[model samples]
Target: MWGRRRKHRPKEYFIFGTIQEEDRVIRINPSLDQPFVPLWFLRYVLYHEMLHSVVPDETVSGGRRRVHTEEFNRRERDFPSYCRARRWEEENLARFLR
Candidate 1:
């Protein structure tokens, strides 16, 4: 599932994407729904959130929920253009805040 759009609030930290696991939903930040954002980058973020739905979460000793385990990270790199998309985010994230 998808398509929940909302405006970003001032002083609110940015979130590029998120997954609601129980609902099996993936949401892309409305800021990224622009022509300037590459399609590959959008796909990368959507894919990342979708992974949270399929990948099993780990419960640690303190009963902490760990979403991004080693295997999850490894699988994330399998996405084509992963590195390029991440680099693009690092370089241009500030621009999206607008």
Candidate 2:
């Protein structure tokens, strides 16, 4: 992920990573590239984005795309440090917000 200037905003929402399915490209938020950020946490975010490639999105009613399907979440939890990674995110989210 490449760093770029962004407008300051509240910490109400944040996206750790994303994937462009058509281009098969993954983009992680540059905020996660900090000294305090753990490598395992970074890997977890990457794994989540990579999962998008294998787990198909579900087409819900009205044709809305459901990116994180039940199957996707199930597989995500299969990650070795899923719980720990999530806990770390919750604890360290404020760092990225700044």
Candidate 3:
């Protein structure tokens, strides 16, 4: 599922993508569809969402559910472009916020 891009205010937090375990749906932010958005970064987002299907969430103190557990993080880092994708996001996030 490709989600429509919403207008985001500057300095606000944004979700690049998400996965719904129950519905088995992975929704990607349409902002990434731009020509300037690198394919590796897009693949990274899809990979992150796909991981949610395989990695189970963890229950922590106060009964809180942690989706990105230590194990999940470890697996996420396995992606070849993980570091580059992160750096790209950090440097270019403001462009997408528009």
User: Which structure among the candidates has the greatest lDDT?
Assistant: 3
Give the Å error, residue 36, model 2. Answer: 0.5
Rank the models by lDDT, top first: 3, 2, 1
lDDT of 2 by residue, 1-98 (tens): 64354677457778888888788688888777778889999899999999999999999999999999999999999999999999999998777765
lDDT of 2: 0.86
Best candidate, TM-score: 3
lDDT of 3: 0.88
lDDT of 3 by residue, 13-90 (tens): 768898887797888888778899998998999999999899999999999999999999999999999999999999
Clashing pairs in 1: none
lDDT values for all models: 0.83, 0.86, 0.88
Which tens-of-lDDT digit does each residue in 1-98 have in candidate 1? 34556654654466888887577667777778779999999999988998888789999889999999988999999998999998998999788666
- When summed lDDT is taken over every stretch of 10 residues in candidate 3, the lowest stretch is 4-13
Better of 2 and 3 by TM-score: 3
Cα shift from native, residue 81, model 3 (Å): 0.9
Residue 97 lDDT (model 2): 68
Over 4 Å off, model 3: 7-11
RMSD of 1: 2.2
TM-score of each: 0.83, 0.86, 0.88
